[model samples]
Target: MGEGAWSCQQSPAILLAMPAQPASSLPNGVVQSEATARALIDAVVSNELSAFRQGPLSPAELAAQTQQPVYRALRCIRKWEKMGVLRVHSVHKRAGRPIRRYALSAPSFFIPAQVLPLEDVAGIVSRPLEQQLHAHVAHALREVVGLQGSEVFLEPRRYGAFLVSAPGQVWDGSGENLPVLANRWATLKLSYADACAMRDELDEVFARYADRAGPQTYWLHLRLVPETSKA
Candidate 1:
């Protein structure tokens, strides 16, 4: 996605809902300058996409959803609209200006994955093709773990299925050795069939938002490594 990928955004903001509040309840910290558009985009991509698609942000919803001023939020919405991620789903013709409802053209905004080739990579450099793949995975794992730290989830399967998400929440995975390593990382070893299911879900989600992040927005880091080894 290059450097400018993270700053992109959508318009007709539906995912965020500001709650009904008296004028006094409006956040004093509303985004001041247009320069803060990057922050609005960041918040939308990182946390609001799932919610926005459901409906438009009512005046009440806007106050409840974001601290940015309504205009600033609108700015982000217009930007996203320009990016082509959001589109008109409906229009509420009020007494005054028409209220337009927007929907996401896609579910997710994709953040580019970074693959750093390790210097003097062990296990991979001199190993057979099969072993080299293992080494490659292991090396990639280390890099992902080192960067994401707490964000990199690893839970054991004996506890239950790790890929399962609750209700509308997604982004779930766990590993067997996770219990052993309080601060370490491990793979979410699913049965081959189960692994395939998780892979499909991830691919779906990844495809949805893979290209939404703008140029200046902070990137969300994600990596999935699966293992077929028996317990």
Candidate 2:
């Protein structure tokens, strides 16, 4: 192996002790920026449960796999933990030092599993406005084109920029904690709250985007998902 090549596995302490690697090894499409990398890490953690399902991968493993710094990975993980998106399992003794493993707290009771994975959703947010608009319009076209799919979209005129959200799946609980939602004129990220909150938020935004509640009108599909097909 070349100097840059990493061993398949190592103790947490040993892994941490090794120098940081350059960003070149990340998956082809990964963004090179740290801010972007942090978001990518969030996307990764949100969609896939921790590797063992017992808890999240060790901090070392995350850094190794993502090629991000240990502190950077931990920072993003900590934020999600605060948002109740994840939880830390008990600290363990590894390489004779304390190692903390994190894990998803619960299947975001907020969105259903069938909804598009968060990585896909994040991909949508990370795109340029023109691209986002194009993607949104394309989704609406699906119904016209006879394609089977669901999409979440938003138009933010008063807020200065339009927001669109689309998902690959529309399972139950998909709307919870969504990054973009608007009602009439107000907007906010989806939160853990009453269904009335969701309706109020959606309705208010729709009033602005859609002239009326009728079908022909256009309103952002904040969280449209198809029911899971029972196999």
Q: Pick the candidate with the highest TM-score.
A: 1
Give the range where candidate 2 is weakest over 10 consecutive residues by summed lDDT.
7-16
In candidate 2, position 158 carries an lDDT of 25
- Model 2, 114-179: lDDT tens per residue? 343544444443344336455666664443422344454344522233232324432332343332
Number of the top candidate by lDDT? 2
- Candidate 2 ranges with C-alpha deviation above 4 Å: 1-55, 94-97, 111-231
- Candidate 2 residue 155 Cα shift, in angstroms, is 32
Q: Model 2: C-alpha RMSD to truth? A: 19.9
lDDT of 1 by residue, 1-231 (tens): 221122123322332333322222112323333323333344544554434645555433443576657676676667655655455656788898887765554443322122212221212222333454455545544643222322223445233222223432322334443211112244665787886677677667755776676553322223345443762
Taking all chains together, each candidate's TM-score versus the true structure is: 0.31, 0.30
Task: Indicate the residue-level lDDT of 46 in model 1.
Answer: 54
